[model samples]
Target: MHATLTAPSARRTRDRATLVCGIAGLASCMIVIMADFTTATIYERLGLFADTISAMAAGRGAMIMDTALLILVGGIVAIAFGLWRQRLPGWRWRAVIIALLAVAGIIAAIALFNEYGDGDVNDSWTFHYRLVYALGIIFTAVPLLAAHDLKPIDRRLWLGSYALGAAWFVAGPLMFTVPTGWDGLLERVAAGIMLLWLIGASIFLIRQPDGR
Candidate 1:
């Protein structure tokens, strides 16, 4: 009886942790976007296409974005851990967690390096930074496709993930073809897809019973 009771208690704790991490990840994304818009200067507009959000990590009024990114990284790391605890079978879930952690590492690197301006566009660090961002999103989505097969995950959730993944994948290429001022708009749309998934998944986890 004692052993059974302890198991249920532990499961409950894990469930709570997952819910909290999901909320954290969703909140981090919101805070980052808010900071970027709220702190923008008169000349800068959130709708302008500026490559990565890190483009604003430096210069005047950049501290809010920088700090928000750091918080976002922390939230991502926590979400990865929370997913790992779910122990969904097969290598797919493991791959998902690894991919998220890798992305978190890249985000941290971006925060530390600080993109100044378009001058060093051809620099080695800049190249790697952009490459990693592209790779991270691709890798993250690939694993997510496999997650749909996991029994514990809601079918609707996985379907939503696939839809969002497709949108994000397409949005990146669309950035190059859109009108001059639309780059930022497309970028936010892509990022918002993933953020919506994070928020939905968190709420799902919170509502699920301790087991199953």
Candidate 2:
């Protein structure tokens, strides 16, 4: 006979996994950033900009970059699955979870199909890679928006998600107007904001009591 599924236990496990993966992913990114000893300032070089690193030949930080990205993508996929396992209240909630999963999938794709090498921006893979990255950023906020419905008590969390989304939207266009040196800085800010939102949401999910 098949064993009966325990909803509460399953939910706790999922929540814990989500929290752990979220933190792990962020930590991996930080490690990658620190390992990069390039002369370019953080502001001058976009945070984790694939083109600046990940080259097979000249990539100063390729090993750490690839390792961190693999870890980050794996963690993201785990977190997305964890969120999906939860018993969302309605179809709308389910759709949100699916969207989050899609975002994670896209990230995984980017990690798998990375830039050819440093200064490989003109390549077709690099072009698609950049496009997917932008799309991922745009959709990152959907889970946060759906979180508003999941956890009504935490008005601040959902509001923060909306704010991040708006900021990302505005920042994308504004980056072009800013000095070229600041492009990396702007991209980092947008990415950092999204990561913060994920961290907050993961914490909230962790603290929720069973059956929530």
Quick one: best lDDT, which candidate? 1
TM-scores of the candidates in the order shown = 0.80, 0.68
Question: Residue by residue across 1-212, what tens digits does model 1's lDDT show?
Answer: 89987997997787788878777777787787787776555325543365345555555556777788788788778777767776677776777777777777777766766654456544856565485566546545643654565434567766777776777677667755787566666766766766676665555555654454
Q: Tell me the tens digit of each residue's lDDT in model 2 across 118-141.
A: 355557556655755565564655
Candidate 1, residue 17: Cα displacement in angstroms equals 2.2
On the 0 to 100 scale, the lDDT of residue 137 in model 2 is: 61
- lDDT scores of the candidates, listed in order: 0.66, 0.56
